[model samples]
Target chain A: MLAEGRIWKFGDDIDTDLIIPARFLNVSEASALARNCFADLRPDFAASVRSGDILVAGNNFGCGSSREHAPLAIKAAGIAVIIARSFARIFYRNAFNIGLPLIESAEASEGLAEGEKSRVDLSAGTILRISDGARFTAKPVPDFMAGIIRAGGLVPYTIERIKAGS
Target chain B: MPMTITEKILAAHSEKEVLSPGDLVQVKVDMALANDITAPIAIKVFGEIGRESVFHRDKVALVADHFVPNKDIASAEQVRIARDFARRHKITHYYEGGDVGIEHVLLPEKGLVLPGQVVIGADSHTCTYGGLGAFSTGVGSTDLGVIMATGEIWLKAPPTIRVNYEGRLNPFVGGKDLILHLIGMIGVEGALYSALEFGGAVIEAMPMYQRLTMANMAIEAGGKNGIVEPDEITKAFVKERGPEAEAGAVYYRSDPDAVYERVITVNVSDFGPQVAFPHSPANIRDISESGTVLLDQVFIGSCTNGSLEDLRDAASVLKGHRAARDIRLIVIPGSPRIYMEAIREGIIETFMEAGAVIGPPCCGPCLGGHMGILASGERALATTNRNFIGRMGHPESEVYLGNPFVAAASAVLGRIGAPGEL
Candidate 1:
């Protein structure tokens, strides 16, 4: 799914703690988590976010602790894609596993304005700046991951695979 | 081409006869684990599956850590459910206070964990066992519970990220600090969804126990696992625990031209005991730089910092002074084994005589469920992993996170201080 959205800018290493701090960890539901996404690092995040927004962050968008709640919260909060210079390992996997698109583009973090709208082309592996005609190449997803996305995430894809064999 | 050890294990289990990065495969788990925090939820989901339990009984481990000596009914009930579930499922090797330590520490130490085995723990630190050459990772409770009942889970093999840290460690700068430095450079997610291969002189120079600490924190930076190539140090670690653990042991190295999604080089000598201020482990600062933080308590425990060496470091600074009367210092050994060794060496008595409370071997104040939690507006310094607000107790309580020496010196000053300042 291709979507055009404004940038939600973040600084270096916006960790899981910033996204959904450990204090909120006891609560397991994703809906409750949306209230606290970037609550610590950016207190106004929830109010500032628009539907189908893209988070453009300087290095390490999701780092510190393997809390799945972090990405689940961002997805529930209407974030379309997270374009970062780098992604923390576990969160990257968790994001894609849950069907959240994360693209890596250095310019997205540096060149894009917070309110700037951008088009993320999943199949083309490109993020086009609608406001500035700037284009950035996102690292291509491996063919296997592409299949999981086509199948709509790990749990659904896994269930489908198991059922197909049965 | 000769296969890597990881490739061998994956190929053996792949139904498609080929394994590649991001290829989701449901393979057999060598072991599955859960702790007090994650176990209850896992049990709930495992029961929901309505599936018959087929997992090997001996391959599951459960440890009561986070809220041990239960401070409240929620934690108390969490353990009770896990305790009953462990029994119902015939899941033997459930380790508690005396036999139990941090899941990461207790697993490898008890010889239950072996190399080349695929281990899954509901806790994030499950990746720690990769230090022993296992393809270990963490998952959510629902995922873990399914694996518990079915003995299988899906994995999307990640691209490798190789970090070659070469050089001798500066004195008293432990693996905890080094990993913190790496997190700073990597910004926590540079190695996302990848295996971190740690090699070169710096890793080799670290002892087995230290390597375990490093691996445990790998998950903190969002890695699936952090692995150190098995060496003589690893062999000695297995041998010292009174068992031949080599049967399941395996080692992996990077190909000369092995493609890495990212490669980071770090220098440990320049780094010192780092602390996270406010919250989040990534809020790192050198110990010496945090000269003005006032303290209410200093904690030394958890699978991460409660080793013999860590205890010794704390005791060294604490020998001459008492903790500030208002500041509480708590030290818990990771395992009963480490506790026994520390007692024999008089570390426990030293701490006790210094007005520190010695809790049982368990995770305390790290996840902030119970024991040593700070009060609102009060401050404390800790050696635990996360320093996130309310992570060690009250959401308003402040935690200044540091390593053992920094915590100890801060304990002496009743505020944050560098190691040698005392």
Candidate 2:
């Protein structure tokens, strides 16, 4: 799948609490969580984020907490893909489990400017900076993760497995 | 290749002879856990999967500790979902009301997790069980749901980082300080996707509670898990819990020739009480180097340090002195068992005499769910795990983390001071 969007840049150690504060965690609805995405760190995120916008962040994105709410909030907030220099282990798994694509590209994370248009070819594992015509390669998603993404996340993938008697 | 304890545990559960870092394997979980914050989501996904019953009713644990006693209608609803699901599934380890405690502490206290077992929880602090030699880590709610249905989850075998702490610990320095110091040394992502196997004289001499404290904060360092090999201490602790606990327990240690991704050694002779500054646990400084930062509140509880020993330490410091006139000291014993033990030992009276409020056994203000939340400009010193931005309340509010001794002493001084200062 190809994703085209404007970039929203963030720095390192962007934690789960900042993505979706604990105050709003009582509610698990996707839209309810989306409304409070980045409620504390970026007060304008929920309202200003456009659909299909890409997020670029520094190291250890989603560092604290194992709340899937953090990833669900970002995905519901119209973030099509997250390109980070790195990601915390659990958040990396949670995002893909929910079918939210993430790319690891230090070059793209550093080279892309905020609000600049970009295109990400998910299967091709390449990122294109539309404005500057700069291209960067992302580490290919692992084989197992690629399969999960193709099946539209873990729930459906798991459902298929259970049905197939595996 | 010879294997570390983590790889050995994974290999045993996955039915593999050997495993390597970055190898994806599907392993059966000995115990699967979810709390109020994550259980509702897991329940929803389980409903979508249309599973009639959980994979193993005895293996699944649902605890309503976070925002428990129902912080609000919303939190009440979340707990209700977990309660209903637990009842529907006849989950053997459903805890609530008088029985509930922080999931990480509650699990070990009940002997639900054992050595050489692969345990997974929806909460990040699930690694706490690794202190008992279990290979435990956190996963998302959906992952828990899948595990509930299939009794298995996919995991990448993490490379192991062996951290050896030699030398005698300084006065008042404990597991909380040591873990904080380690995180400060190796930034948050230092151990990312790796298992931290703690060893050396200090770790061997450390008590079970202290070891659990260190393992509890492993996630703060971006670790997949933090483990200490099972020894006489682990065996004694498990045996005391009951016969059932010792039944399936298998103590596994890393082979002498096991490979490690990195080996880090620290001499603890000079290490003192360490405090993680606001906004990040990695922003650490020795208490001696920490400036006079006043506090609005001091919380001396959580899965990290809310054990019986932690309460004893805090009560010892607060025996005679009362909290500063304007400061709020909230003491939450980790579980009902610990609370009752404190009551039996007169520790509750010490805290009450210190002008502190004793909260029920729940997460309390750690996650900013309820209890003593901070205002915009307020600051707090806590014995809990993370001090991320806005963790305890308002976004502008700040939190500092230290040991229970520091927390109690800071309450008396109304600032971030230590027991020696008191």
List, residue by residue over B306-346, the lDDT tens digit for candidate 2. Answer: 99999999999999999998799999999999999999999
**Two-chain complex of model 1, DockQ on C-alpha atoms against the true structure:** 0.23
Candidate 2 residue lDDT tens string, A81-128:
999999999999999999999989999889988999999999999999
Worst 10 residues of 2 chain A by lDDT: A128-137
Q: After superposition, how far is residue B252 of candidate 1 from its true place, in Å?
A: 4.9
Scored against the true structure, residue B211 in model 1 reaches a CA lDDT of 77
TM-score of each: 0.81, 0.99
Q: Which predicted model would earn the best DockQ?
A: 2
Name the 10 consecutive residues with the lowest summed lDDT in model 2 chain B.
B101-110
Provide the lowest-lDDT 10-residue window in model 1 chain B: B1-10
Off by over 4 Å in 1: A1-12, A30-58, A74-86, A98-143, A146-153, B2-27, B40-50, B71-84, B95-100, B149-169, B184-186, B241-246, B251-293, B375-379, B388-401
Task: Write down the TM-score for model 1.
Answer: 0.81
lDDT of 1 by residue, B321-364 (tens): 78877789999887888899999999888888888999888887
In lDDT terms, which candidate is top? Answer: 2
| Off by more than 4 A, model 2 | none
